[model samples]
Target chain A: MEKKKTTIILFSGDYDKAMAAYIIANGAAAYDHEVTIFHTFWGLNALRKDENIEVKKGFMEKMFAKMMPRGADKMGLSKMHFAGMGPKMIKDVMKKHNAVPLPQLIEMAQEQDIKLVACTMTMDLLGLKEVELLDNIEYAGVAAYLADAEDGNVNLFI
Target chain B: MEKKKTTIILFSGDYDKAMAAYIIANGAAAYDHEVTIFHTFWGLNALRKDENIEVKKGFMEKMFAKMMPRGADKMGLSKMHFAGMGPKMIKDVMKKHNAVPLPQLIEMAQEQDIKLVACTMTMDLLGLKEVELLDNIEYAGVAAYLADAEDGNVNLFI
Candidate 1:
């Protein structure tokens, strides 16, 4: 069978959504297909090893955060403060569920020849220097993502 | 404790997403919180009592359609076209799942006093007349969704 190339343009600033992109892109890799994920805006946070992700919280956010054991970790809320139930719950879930960290997932994608692109505009707007970002990301402009998107691959906004 | 209201924007034109929105809104209603689902774009398609959702070909998107069930229906690419394996899988998995249907979920939200807002911009773009939509949908614009989302409440876009 002839191999088909499909690129996915994921646009999202939401932490939970960035996590979703990682999951979906990883799943695509398992299928032995060419997968490219474009991360922009809020998505850039996922590529950082720095603990800077911040999800705004109020009474409900705090209350809701407590009820869920794994909190944002299991719920795919990457930007959640202290991961809902804090680092312990997140570590526990990661071990028990075999959930891969976002960074590790990117590594796996790289091993599988998956192309990872980061939006340059978002980086500039957010004041993210190349030195600040992780090693695996490719910086580009709208034309880069749009070119892939127009190829009829897949354009997704998370 | 004072009760807070949140606007949950459900931007789905797909059958399954509409269904997910209804179920999620229903879940939020269980918390006795006010929920508003703003349906716009392709999401308007689900409100129509007519037409079947399609799940496109390809294993991943189809599997996603089958797994998510509601989000994929809008594509109209049911798995049945493939010797019945796909559709049957979708049905079997759906049986064990407990998500509410789009219509019923909407009713549950309304009965529980959850607000429903439909996007007028999307309606115009899709050439959908107000009469073509479901009865409970309140049509508005981006300004409306933003206005509702402004209250520092839990905001979700599904």
Candidate 2:
């Protein structure tokens, strides 16, 4: 029998939203399902690092990288974001709940061998370079995601 | 023949995200799928009206309703929100793309008889009252949503 397949399109880069996406992906993987998370657009921000890294890119792309949040810890909240404090409050709540932070969640997802594919189109559009992202991830476009989703029993956009 | 079920959990109340959710729900309904949008938490904000209406609620509830955006039109963007102006820019982009606004897309969903259910638990948490929300919608808890999702061919959270 074919293994149960779950394909998720993680489209939000907000800290809380990214947490939800990773939580679902980890849950599916725990159920013995083949899971794929296609990160696109702002979702790519979750993969960025806080420290500046040299990557050959145009002026605009480099500027985009500088402007956006470096990683999950630096991301803003989707709502109640009173400046940057909303994310801090939510992080405090998460710690209280014993929920792992977004970075840790991403590490767990990788440990589970869930396929994390960065959308190349978004990378080009946002001017994100591979050196800025964490290791152990694949790169693909919408066509690749569609091909995987077409065969999957479950498909989600988040 | 039974229609395929598509149940979406509208967890984010961001204007663009709500637009995406409604667009998907409308698309699924057009394809003859039984579509249900279970609005919960911040998602409930999309169903609110812009005008203030007197509703019988506790002090905390009323305060919540007052602080949050009344309707879909008043919602801010999930990201890049420059003091609430980011939504305006996105609306401009949507207009250029000839995409309908969130309110119109919602009307379209209702016209198609797509099931729009509000999460009671979230209502209690957020202090939203039915009087402040758009009419002709169902109210239910997670049990009801779970029942719908159990048979759903596609389930999404956004």
Candidate 1: stretches off by over 4 Å: A1-157, B51-88, B96-99
Please state the error at residue B82 of candidate 1 in Å. 6.1
Each candidate's interface RMSD: 17.2, 4.8
Worst 10 residues of 2 chain A by lDDT: A89-98
Q: Per-residue lDDT tens digits of candidate 1, residues B112-140?
A: 97877766644443345555555665777
Compose the digit string of candidate 1's lDDT tens values, residues A1-158: 53434455555543334444565566555655456788776566556545333445566544533443221233333222343432343344444446565556667787887888878887666555565556766889889877765543223456
**Native A-B contact fraction in model 1:** 0.00
Please, what is the TM-score per model? 0.43, 0.66
> Every model's Cα RMSD, please?
19.0, 6.1
lDDT of 1: 0.55
What is model 2's DockQ versus the real complex?
0.21
Best by the lDDT measure: 2
